[model samples]
Target: MEEANETIVAEFMLLGFSGVHDKLQMFLFFVLLLTYLVTLTGNLLIVFIVWVDHRLHTPMYFFISNLSFLEIWFTLVTNPKMLLNFLSDSKTISFLACMAQSYFYFTLGAAEFILLMVMSFDRYVAIYHSLQYAAIMKQRLCIQLGFVSWVGGFLIISSWMVLVYKLRFRGPNVINHFFCDSTPLFQLSCNDTQLIKRVDSILLSSIVLTSLCLTMISYASIFYSILRIPSATGRQKGFSTCASPLTVVVMAYGSCFVLYGRPTGYLSLEINKGVTLLNTVVYPFLNSFIYSLRNKSVKLALRVAFSHNKTKLFPKLCCAP
Candidate 1:
């Protein structure tokens, strides 16, 4: 085989939402800015609540805290750059910077996939073997599982990024998407990317599809276990506990599989952009609300934290001194 020439391009112009009218771009700027802020605050609040509230120190909340932390960095990796691009006339990102963004973006995403699976297992153990749940999901085990998810995700993506870095980009440095994703970046490569494309498809499909399958299986077992419970209230409580995470799992995996599960040739930039928005932008913001608002423990924790802060801030007023 002939050698492919290396990329001469030093920078890439991220043509983010250039198709949108200026007014709409400005509208999107604020909307995305607000969304980012909310995503940060919400996910951070979950982390804080989990940290301070002893009631939430179970294996389930432990996994949630990890997910919330992942969302913080996950949203941070892309949104700030996308937000800046929306405001600026020059949407140029250095090739190295673009690659870095892509690396972290996929890394965090993979971590989330594994973390969600860990959470499903936590739920399964909690329901399936209630007596042994505590024994099985001890603090050391939970920490190890969480650590493996983060490390495994990074390792998986690191190998893929090495391939991405090797691909040559001769010219036309405009990426027609908000971020440097594998699909868009692969489209820009000048070399024979057939091998990389196949590798990417297989890796993404294996990680996402496998995790999704495991999650579904865990939920199935949990559901069966719930059915065996004679009390309606017990069943309702069981469903309530599982509902929020299940919703998140569905949303996260659904968007991801649609975007990354298939070959690059099959993807449309317009549709991909919309799906990216849902997966990256919308889901992070929604995750906190889904996990927190629906959770009684989280609600109570928030109220207690708020009251504690209020008392600290205005002790005399609160105490009627």
Candidate 2:
């Protein structure tokens, strides 16, 4: 009977902020829709700017482009479905769909984690070894680092996905979050999940701790190098360059630590939902803004692109007989 019940559960209902009032839900729908559009536009613009501007063709821009690309898919995996659920009465996701969402969510998320660390290292190299920065961070090396971030992140989370796929959901099919996160899924599993929980703790701790430590070390070295410079201009320039990546790291790592740093049982669902919303929806928007505002190269690229487009359009309009 237990086995039959497990097999019978084929779909999971996502209870995404269902406790909110109707008016609040409607307001949230438009708000999230606007956020989605802005996130897409901002990240896509960064990608375009990095690709077309030869002057901005450095290792830093290359990594920024890759990070922008990752942010696009990262928000896509869950935000659209969440928007749909805001309007629909039935917020059910299939077993397969949930699994796919979870996989992509973790994949892009983990990739961003490593990518940010890589960006930190790039800064360290640029500041600490300015003379050899070009030689050290050649095109080949940049591409390889980006590739490793994506592939390594995927590999790290693949085991968790496998374990999740094997778990059986028998009775309660409701997930009390926006998307198919492992925490809620674990709660609904009929099988013993002690091993899965332990593995999750180990993996999350190892990855987050290692990445955080490396990022810290890179920044510490970077600051030490900056302080030793005699010129205030050089010190200011160093701080300015590191600002964007540092902001992103703080937001990304802070949210992650709050969400996954502790045992799942200790977290409140409401707090988790809010934190997840900030992490998934708000952070992408913030990331793009931070980079664009702080990085002069990206700002120049944007200005050049816009001016070139306007010039081309103006000539065509004015030439119309």
- C-alpha positional error of residue 41 in candidate 1 after TM-score superposition, expressed in Å: 0.1
lDDT (tens digit, per residue) of candidate 1 on 253-277? 8898788766565778888898999
Q: Write the per-residue lDDT of candidate 2 for residues 7-83, one digit (tens) a residue.
A: 55788899998999999999988999999899999999999988999998999989999999999999999999999
In the order shown, the candidates' Cα RMSDs to the true structure are 2.4, 1.9
Error of 1 at 167 (Å): 1.2
Query: At residue 208, what lDDT does model 1 achieve?
Result: 88
lDDT score of residue 284 within candidate 1: 97
Query: TM-scores of all models?
Result: 0.96, 0.96
Task: Give the Cα lDDT of each candidate.
Answer: 0.91, 0.91
The TM-score obtained by model 1 is 0.96
True-vs-predicted CA distance for residue 249, candidate 1, Å:
0.7
Q: Which 10 successive residues of model 1 have the least lDDT summed?
A: 1-10
